[model samples]
Target: MNLWPTYRCAGIKVVHIADDWSSATVRLKLGPLNRTIFGTAFGGSLSAMTDPFFTLLALKQLGRGYIVWDKAAEIEFVSPGRGTLTSTMTLPPEEVARIRAATSTGEKFLKWYATSIVDAEGRPVAKVRRQIYVRRKRGSC
Candidate 1:
């Protein structure tokens, strides 16, 4: 999403998305647009960096028959982020299987996923949790 206006303006970049759509790595660089006055990563930027990946992976993996939406989120700032920070989001196979089974009857399922945004040294800058809603499409069952 590097070229997407919101991400681009905030210096957020999608570093990689796995071929199987199971995971993704996103980066936020400390730059003019995303840094706080004290020269650390902006809290909003840190939070924004983690906004969509988990649901994105879920949607891609679930493909055509399901609807996935990022239902909720929370972010805890662990430390000041200088330089670059990265967050990698993954949806495990078992979780996907569980989602499939849970939603097979057209019932909605809510799943929470966590990811740590870390600085260049691998120290945590923020801890983020995202809850996604998944359901089978009405006519797809």
Candidate 2:
């Protein structure tokens, strides 16, 4: 089940997912349902829009032999998010390799990734940091 479309009700739209699962772009549109009383994007919506991406991307790249989950997250609102805002999640190949190497012995790996939510004009609205937990499943590798 692809979570991108499933999360649309929250005003989060998945704009793109790279073929390699190394990158993804998601947009949070400012609408009645997702706006605050100040007419800006709701803070909760901004946080929710970024909730599952890092873990999901890692899961896809790590394959079935690995277990991945969202361990923690933090969002700093820099400015009121007006109009449509977007954030791109990217995991470099080196990072993936490092994760794999670290978890090769069935140990857990926790890595933090950062992304910026920017407005239509490309100004920063918020900064989101997500820590993902990953491990190699026992007997699978």
Candidate 3:
């Protein structure tokens, strides 16, 4: 995608983006580009993989009436984060429906979600938490 190099997240390639509105996963690989001096994936890159999913998923499933944001985030470094890291993001049908029901009344609230950062071999390297604000825009929709 055009955004891979624009934001310097080239190593953070999006491997799977399904049209059914169910899932997405950002892939990481070991190479000279995104590596640190210790030969590990950069922590910032790991964190960056998580940014847009929450908002994009919400918009895709909930339609145009609501606003979603990456309100807050925290990460736990569980390993050396060597070789590579992959972050998988998913939004279940029930949760998406819940958001629509809660915000349909035109009120705003802060919501939170979390994901795990895993190595190439599927070991968890870190845990990430994200907060999003949901609301309806005035006079817009």
Candidate 4:
């Protein structure tokens, strides 16, 4: 679901969508709205980079009869992101299947996933863990 434009509208840029899964790389050009007091990228902006991908991918591959939401989250800032930050997200087929199987009974389940934010040199600047909560639709397959 085209979240890139929405991100860009707020000054974050969607760099690329990997051919594998719905994992995408999104970057933001620091501006008044997103700049920190010292003029570096704001923590909130950096944190927001991990927002949409994993759960979106889960929803798409998981198909109907399920709802996905961010359940738990942790972000470790390894360094202050100055410029050109990139975040990558991916999900494997088996993981998708597991989540699906676990929630097939209309019971809610939480799944853990991760994403890494790297600098232009490909060194990790931050690691984000996303816990996705899923629940099945009533009387639906």
- Best model per lDDT: 1
**Span of 10 residues, lowest total lDDT, candidate 1:** 44-53
Root-mean-square deviation of every model: 0.9, 1.6, 1.9, 2.3
Each model's lDDT? 0.89, 0.89, 0.77, 0.77
Off by over 4 Å in 3: 6-10
Q: Evaluated with TM-score, which candidate comes out highest?
A: 1
- Please provide TM-scores, in order, for all candidate models, with all chains considered together: 0.96, 0.94, 0.88, 0.85
- For model 2, name the residue pairs that clash: none
Ranking by lDDT: 1, 2, 4, 3
* Model 4 lowest lDDT segment of ten: 1-10
Model 2, which residues run further than 4 Å from truth? 1-6
**Against the hidden true structure, what lDDT does model 3 obtain?**
0.77
lDDT score, candidate 4? 0.77
Please state the error at residue 123 of candidate 2 in Å: 0.6
Candidate 1, residues 1-141: lDDT per residue as tens digits? Answer: 788898988889999988988888999988998888899998888878878888888888888999999999999989889998999999977789999999998899997899999999999999999999999999996
Q: Which digits, one per residue and each the tens of the lDDT, describe model 2 over residues 21-86?
A: 998998888888889899999888899878788998888888999989999999999999999899
Worst 10 residues of 2 by lDDT: 1-10
lDDT, candidate 1, at 44: 84
Those runs of model 4 whose alpha carbons end farther than 4 Å from true positions after fitting are: 1-6, 18-20
